[model samples]
Target: MSSRLYILLLVLLIATGGCRRGTDAPGIPEYDFMPLEAGRYRIYDVQETQYARNTLPLQHSYRLKETVGPAYTDVSGHRAYRLLRYRQTSNSLSWQPDSIWSVRLVNNEVIRTENGRDFVSLLYPVSNGLRWNGNRYNLWQSEEYEARNVGQPFSVSGKEFGETVTVIASNDSTLIGQTKRVDIYAHQIGMIYKERTYLQFCTDTPACLGKNQIEYGIRQIYRIQTYGKE
Candidate 1:
């Protein structure tokens, strides 16, 4: 390669390196925050809110159960687990089939596929302020995510976890809209809580302009209700 081209290639590699963090340290329970144990499942209480231009924010609640299956080698040669999800409208109602996802851990980086989208859920060696691109494996543009509050006590939905870590997946704000996603995982237990907000405000009306009122958007919260192995 030409000298100029070689320098350019080196710069490109360095730039994309931040998209994924390299970690080979020995694993621990804290690193297993999202365990892949087969037959284990987690139940969550889902609180959803939807907003429209003229309607009051609609509120809906439900329950979700995510179950993991035995490990199998994927086409890419990575060991992956099947994730089957179910939904329940109420405690009295039986669980209905929801969706299927997949989870794989490669070099201490947790890769989860949800609805055909790939995302790096969590990174190993759980340290504070560690950042990586959650969308590095997919074709989508780089989306920065950071680990924070590592190995700290957290409480959610009346359940207190002795130690937990938070992943700030996305946080973007603008005059017209705002989008944010955060998830907390406890030691040995998977995700204990998750919250997401995608909001768009009215910019056409003077009264609501710059006020950031929810003209239309969706906000969802998932908190752990119970969990155990099947």
Candidate 2:
């Protein structure tokens, strides 16, 4: 089938089946009814290859803390999450605000909030200028942020699943023209299975493409969660 047809089919199936707009849908998973709980999750990620070829698929682990408050702070009240990433080999560490996220019970949809304001969509910082929302492909709307590389029938590889979402820095919009992307995958309940990121340096610095380092690790979540409480 053509890419357009495939995307149309995927969207239709997800809309009618994988994702439901109401509780009336049949065969609803038991987990769908229960409110998502607040807890900590670990994520492991690894990259398979290089831009031109697969190489040095690094691995790392991240700690995520999620909380759903009972009271309201701004929009839908207050919800929070914190993520700490640690590289196993180099002892490097990364941190994220654990941006607030919640589920829409009416349609089994997920939403996010920032600084206490509820939004139909959310953007989490990856580096200095970029952000990513996990459900973009499955989300109902893409009217929030301004995406330049937006294309019809956007494609995501099956390898992207089960990993933390990755993106470039919003501050560095210059890199936006370089075809930057955010890769995300979820794994082991609360863990991100594979998260890898790349940034095209447009500056004249040595690290800039053709100068030295063509790209930089804007962010990467490379931890494979092997065991979790089942």
Candidate 3:
């Protein structure tokens, strides 16, 4: 080919590359729900409430800070990431050592092991209505977990995120009572919010079915207050 033609082809290639970098291009990478890396941490404000039949409800609020530490091998011989958790009660002014948790990515799912219980936190290729057994290895029997509102925008603590995912876990039947747990995660970030509601009632008692009857329940909520990396 002539030198002029070669120069023309080079210019066209550069133009194509520039176009791919534009905002309208589809070359951008997707967000990972669990971006486990050392030196990253997130802080959250936690609120816990407990309700029982014929008793006053009790509530407590606090702050929880979690930091990702070095990687280590778990009991199952899988590579896992270590998380150091710090807690600050309402009466305390400083954070203190809380507990240690382990997280691992296995079979395209993000699993977190806390207090000797394994929970499938997030599933790969997350999309709306995606469902799985988040508590398959837990003490809970026959719980169903689902993903919703994937890739949606969300805001927390005055910070905006381009994408977010919500995971819900509950039983299939509510004949006796209902127990639901929800976790919301922001893209590129970890959990931004979490809620759990558990209610139990006497099924065979007529007094328990009364409209004014008291039910035993507990609700806990966690919200992100601030997050950063070390």
TM-score leader: 1
* 151-200 per-residue lDDT for model 1 (tens digits): 89999889899888999998888889999999999988999999999999
Clashing pairs in 3: none
lDDT of 3 by residue, 1-230 (tens): 99999999999999998987785764213658778888889989888888787689888989999999988888788878988999999644888999999898776789998887898888887889999888888766856789998999877778787889988876333656667688889987889988887877656677566343437777788899988899
Please give each candidate's TM-score.
Answer: 0.86, 0.35, 0.78
Question: What TM-score does candidate 1 get on C-alpha atoms?
Answer: 0.86
> How many steric clashes does model 1 contain?
0
lDDT of 1: 0.91
Residue pairs in collision within model 1: none
| Model 2, span 1-230: residue lDDT tens | 99999999988988887445565664333322123343434434344333321235344334443344343333434433322233333225554554544433224333443343344332322222333444354435443232222111222323333223332223233442233333232322332333434545445554553542434344444444442321
- Winning model by lDDT: 1
Q: Which stretches of candidate 3 lie over 4 Å from their true place?
A: 1-29, 138-142, 171-175, 202-205, 210-213
